[model samples]
Target: MAAETDRPAPEALISAFEPDRLLKQDQSGRRIAILGTIHGKQGILTAERAAFATESPEVLKAFHAAITQVTNLGDNDIYRWYLASSGGTNNVTAAAAAQQPPDLKLNLIWPCTESHIKKYSEQVVRMVTETPEIYHDHVRPYMSAKREEGRLNWVFNILEGRTEQEDVILRDEGHRGGAGVAGEYHYDDAFLMLPDLNWDRKTMGSLHLLALVQRRDIWSLRDLKKKHVPWLKYLRQRLLEGTVKMYPELEKDQLKLYVHYQPTYYHFHIHVVNVMLEAGATQATGKAFGLENIISQLETISGDEEAGMADVSLTYFLGEASELWTNVYGPLKRGEKPQAG
Candidate 1:
């Protein structure tokens, strides 16, 4: 396991922030970007790293009470966004502010830097065509190395009930009936759903959820096989039903289900979002593959049950910093044998 690093809470960092300017804001005003300085003197040569402060009880109360002005941005179904302010009347005292930021509710990117700014900002993206040969020869190996390096420790922490237990929306241990029938289902089929970190939990329009499988045999969508169609269908139905049940305002049709090809982590998980949410690059064609489409392909695929996505060619984009790009794809583009991850 990678040694965990001790870091300050977002509240502590926010309390000591010195505002410079609003860097950027988008996502229909659901998010904001600000550039600011902190009082840390350790990194004189390097730019400060960024941190995020979460909403707390005190901050949430002030945020709700300090609305002196409001400008409606737009709405999707029952969801609404606005640009509002407290008219600066609810400002905290200097002493109070100095100790911890005023009663303000805002996300922070503390210890941030110019590099992070560029990373978050838009940049040119290139698409790569990944044939089955490329996947077998390169991508699979790279994924294995990443997993071996303990990159999935955080995922295991959640699965093992070591962290974020309270946030779990639903956990299905593949139980269909009494204990006698439990053996009929594979243990690997067990999964749990949770609110994605990007979600504020209150925004119905921007609803984003994740369903992470308990099994480790399947790393990415590429590992899915025709035999798993039943499991896939079962998962899809439960996820959709569970989300709508959690928020009575949403219908099953309002949710969109998909999985990323080159997912951020190697674990098998599905991304469920409100259809009304804006389709960003994360939902782009080369990245997100619809669960329904994938299932249909699997059902009709001309092969034995063992045949699956591994036999098909997949195309997607990779950041320049990605290990696959630096060690594999980049070398291939230069007409050299790709290096191992």
Candidate 2:
């Protein structure tokens, strides 16, 4: 446990997101999963917790004494933040051809000044380009497509035989976001809309809009387990039953739902935006994940079986315009030796 570069930092940035602090570590010594999500920042610890969340426990006990005077989450001036793309409500993209991961010496610093690297770019490493491919968010890089017959054949092309209900925004036959019935454990009751809404602008608080679709074609969040915990307990009962049939005054705490580790396309979707925008802020770290921090990392595991979510270890944020991190964390950030995906 000491080896997270010798365990020192966390004096409590919420105890570096507990669940027994997943495995913390990072900065390349690996061990990741500091999962409580929301790394999207505008810093000063998000303006001193929005300036003590409207003050009053005598200014919330001086905001817990200024959050114990922030004990370094790698204090690069409060962990240096930046991400400003406002092309929301309706957008257009394609300026991101920058590719620069060779120098390798980052500690999770994002300077996406004026954004739109498509939902905050963060595919921190992936593989297969020796040919054979498949992906099509209709247009756009759509995570560089590649899959012809096998492997998530587009989740059976949206859960089998299209009846094409005109861009379905919400339907719940029971669970995979709602068309229900997929073996009863790894639900995907379907609630759609992400032919690309990564820069949502249904602007209520800011990041408004939805992206649910789980019908069981497991791919990312390391293909989560414990029988997928009833697809995150049915997206926390649709984020607490805010009755969404196109926002019928929806505001279950401005909705959140999440999951996306290098996801642009590989099926297994769910974004449900707006909790005041920037969930992954133009992405670029281990991609997003927050279904209430993976239902609290599956209510803190039991008998392994993906409930340990691939044994919960972690590390992410590889971007040299990723060809699997220019082929894997640009060769372990240059100490060489990574390749094999």
Give the top-scoring candidate (TM-score): 1
Q: List, residue by residue over 74-190, the lDDT tens digit for candidate 2.
A: 212212212222222123223331221121112333442222243356454343221111111111132223333243443454444342234345555553233432343534355
Q: How many backbone clashes does candidate 2 have?
A: 32
TM-score list, all predictions: 0.66, 0.25
Model 1 Cα lDDT, one tens digit per residue, 166-245: 88999988755432211344534689998776565666777899999998899999999998887888889889889998
Compared with the true structure, the alpha-carbon lDDT of candidate 1 equals 0.74
Candidate 1: regions farther than 4 A off: 1-123, 176-188
Q: Give the distance in Å from residue 154's predicted Cα in candidate 2 to where it truly belongs.
A: 33
